[model samples]
Target chain A: MERILEQIPRFFSGPNMTLLLEAAGLTLAMTLTGCLIGFGLAFVLVYLRQTPGMWALPLRWICITYVEVFRRIPFIVVIYLVLFFIQAVTPDASLFTIAVIAICLYAVAYTADIIRGGIESVPITQVEAAQSMNLSRLQTNIRIILPQAWPVIVPPAIAFAVSFIKDTALVSQVGVFELTFRGKELNNQGYSGLLVFGTIALCYFLLSFPLSMLGQYLEKRLATPRGERRSRKIRHS
Target chain B: MQHLEVSDVRAKYGTLEVLKGISFSIKKGEIASLVGPSGSGKSTVLRALMGLTPITGGTVMIGNERMNYSSAKEVRAARDRMAIVFQQYNLFQNMTVMQNLTLAPLKIKKWGKTDVITEAHRLLGLVGLSDRANAFPDQLSGGQQQRVALARALALKPQILLLDEVTSALDPELVNEVLDAVRKLANEGMTMIIVSHEMAFVREVADKVIFMDEGHIIEVGKPADIFDNSQTNRARDFFSKILRH
Candidate 1:
């Protein structure tokens, strides 16, 4: 306890603080870049997985297998596997790029199920009504299905991303220089382990706290019916 | 000339056949009501016409054009000429009544925005829902929603309107409001195929009443002939039991 207290000043000095700040920025960058790309690709995966008729059966199987396989594996394993695979294919790939790719791969698997559930939560009757009106499948999804599905999808999706701020620590195993990696380096350089890790923990909380709040706010806002929200807006105006 | 003709239409849910070679035809501006026990394929017939169900072995001819469900473009072409209202009042939950009525016209049909909105307002007035234009579907009663659904279908300017037990999900009191909307459409000479249990309304408005049983058309005649003088025991027994109440 005394050692932790004594080293606190050094731990939070100008140079150490700058290092921590850069690591934090790297962590946030990796998570946001990976998750945003992953979320977009998850939609494509789910759309292909739901392709109608016998012709797309193999495509459907491949999507399903990818989601199931990646979801069941550990995050660290995914990063290592991605590191080796990318190195074999393109030997000069940066560790940071490899980390982002691994995070993206893992995120697509988990969030694909989230997206599929959100889509399926919409009543099939809605699709039928759109179909009868000569609305194409793409039109139905964009106009009718996805708008209704957003209320179900956004909260959990945001929650997943917020939690992923911590999950990104796994990427440091491949030497990506994120928060955990910086903490370890500082500790090895004669800083107290307790002081080093405690600050790192605080940094992660600072990053994720606002995101969690945003998720909660969205959950409450979206759960209200559109008419009620409109009425509220009118009343406020 | 026949406005819509479905001949020898067959449909199946897996190996269990639900519609077995059913045939029916409606002239321009004619109103036909299909009545039968549940699962007798009355609803399936309307679904098959819209290509909602796979018609395994039949052709549908709309005016001079034969509908080919095998080709997606042709199926879409067939769909473009018709609109259907479901029993559950499946309005887009996220949209307001006006948006529901105007979406297909403005988007799919690519009609002018002002013109589609004008037609939407007119149709809403026809269904007595002009005041509920900004209301979401869940805010309205089932009857109002179904009426909005009818107006939404009309906004498409479809040549044929299909009503699949449109009032079945409504309360007893709500049933009349939805039926009144259909009656208004009928008065305007809208061509329609209504699968309904409302025998009294069927008898009053239908130009032809087709009785179905076990996926087959047991009889087809004027409303009075089918209701008061059914040709098949299945039709008579079914009608007597439901109509007695």
Candidate 2:
């Protein structure tokens, strides 16, 4: 424990600190942009679920394919693929922007699925009630369906954001100079592994602590009415 | 000839037909009670008229304008002029009573803020729930929630109000309060198509009573006549079963 405490001072006084902050910035930028893109796309995807006939199957397939591809493939492969195919084709683009965009594209797909499931879980009667009031499909989606779904989907969405924040560590592989990259640079420059890596972990905690707390907060908030913790624990086994 | 006429309307869900060739005419300032056993398609007739359910055949004419199944917009216009109080009390649980009442009116009519609040208050008072306007549905009793739903429905000033077993979900003691509210609405000459099983309420407030069975209108007459002298065995059996239960 004393040794761990001693490591904090050595970690903070390390040379590659600015790069740690840079990495944190890149991670947040990527996650937020990706999540926002994912949120809008998810809303559209879920709303499109209500539209009838020939359009229905195709829209569902698009959403499904998005989730399927992103969920099945490793994020690192996606980054490399983007670097190879998309970046190769586009050129003159910064790697930071490309990495952020890639994360956003991938995150958007997963969030869309989470949001879609949340929307679908809402009672059909609620949708029908809104419609019976002469609320157009758009009004129903915006007012009734999405608001109800938001509370249910938020926990997972936050979890994904935190995980994605950590995933940005993976972005260092793409030469983005995120915190992990700086920590690696510092350690390679002869800073002890304990000090450099400890700083990196602390920076990550600084980024992820609030988000983790928020997820915990949400779990508590959602659980108060349900009192399902015991049941959840029982089911896990 | 009428404010609304449902002519031999048949509604189907999948291959199972719910309302088979039910006909009724609702004049302005009329209150008709529709009563039948559970799953007898009493609610389907109302739903079909609202276009919440698609009609397999026949027509619904609202004040000389034909409601077509070809486009949702056409049916939507007809639905806008009618408000339905459902059995489950489909009030927005998250919204306050005032918000629920004001939402459709403000959204559909685009009423001013003062008008929305004033009108919502007036409607809440009409249902005897003026004091509970700020409460959420979760905060209200089953009876109070139904009252709020009634107020919300009436807030739209619909030409015809559809009460699809609105009191069916209430506790026995709570049932009377909602029934009293409906009775007052009936006295005020609101054109109402009430689908219910509470025989006594139907007898007291309904100007005409319709007895449906297996999607067909087995009997249609005054509440007294249908209750006392059901012409068909199906109607008689239904009346007996529900009343006995």
Candidate 3:
């Protein structure tokens, strides 16, 4: 244990440091881009699934099938499947592009389900109230329903984001040179495996800690009954 | 032209018919109460009129305009001139009392900012919730929340206000505050259709009372007629049972 602790400083020193920093930057880039794309697609999917009428039925079928297909399978299997499918279609596609696409496809399914749950958690009476007030469907959703739903949505969404950030490490298998890939390369060059793995783990913790804390703060803030939330924020912030 | 007329309205939930051809009309500046035992379709009538329930057969005339239930857009256009306060006091839980009252007026009506704010404040004062404007629905008591719901409905300046058992969910002590607000609105000549179980309060405030049973209107008359001098056995039976407790 002490030896592991001692190697931490050495992990940040030497030629290894630059490799670590570069990998960290790539991981951040992939996570940010993938999350944005995935979240947008998931919103479309949930919206299609929630809409009424025959026109939306086929769209909803496609969305439901896509979500179930991706969600039921292993992420690594999904990554390999997408990689092969993309390469078969366009052999010249960049490795980075393939990696981002794979992560986003996997992330979209889970995020869609989480958001749908949030939407359903809002009471039916809310929509009825909006209807009676003569607010359009778009106005009702944006103003009444979404605001009520976010309290249920934000915690799960952040959890998925942190998980997806870690999942970006899986892209290393496809030659993306993200964090895990860098750690493995350093290990191959005769560096202690313990130090390399430990450093990678530390980087992940550093990246995810603040985000997790922010989610907790949000959940707590929302849990406070509405009127008091503003005053409490003022008191603390 | 009548203020509102529901003619031969028929509604159903799957195979079970809830309103099997009920007809009623109210004049402008009239406060009508629908009093009946549970499952008598009093609430269904309110829901049908508000476009919440599908009226499979019937015509609803608001002033002289026929309510267009042909499409959702048309239904919304028809509903734009009316509002309903639900039994559950469905105030948007995320909004403060002030926002609940002002949201539709500001968003749907496109009212000016100063006008909307002033109107919300006025209605809040009218409901005796002037100081609780910043309180969220959950933060306030049941009575306060229902009052906020009433003020929110009034903010739209709806031509017809539908109240669906507004006092049913409140504590006995809390019931009076909500009923009092409704009474004040009645005095001011708001055209309202209230489905209430509060027999005495209904008698006191309603200009006309309609007694319903088994999805049919058994009697429609002045409050004293139904409550005191009923002409139908069904109305007399309902009044005796409900007013006994």
Best by TM-score: 1
Docking class of 3: medium
Candidate 2's docking class is acceptable
> How would the candidate models be sorted by lDDT, starting from the highest?
1, 3, 2
Predicted structure 1, TM vs. truth = 0.96
**Which pairs clash (backbone N, Cα, C closer than 3 Å) in model 2?**
A23-A178, A23-A179, A34-A104, A38-A108
Sort every candidate by TM-score, greatest first: 1, 3, 2
Winner by DockQ between candidate 3 and candidate 1: 1
Predicted structure 2: lDDT:
0.81
Span of ten consecutive residues with least summed lDDT in model 3 chain A: A225-234
Clashing pairs in 1: none
Question: What value does the lDDT take at residue B214 in candidate 3?
Answer: 83
| Residue A190 lDDT, candidate 1, scale 0-100 | 91
lDDT of 1 by residue, B149-194 (tens): 9999889998999999998899999999998989988999999999
Evaluated at residue B243, the lDDT of candidate 2 is: 71
Candidate 3, B32-127: lDDT as tens digits:
999888999999998888888888998888888888476887688778878899999999987889889888888889899999999899998899
Query: What clash count does candidate 1 reach?
Result: 0
**Chain B vs. true chain B: TM-score for each candidate?**
0.98, 0.95, 0.97
The most accurate candidate by DockQ is: 1
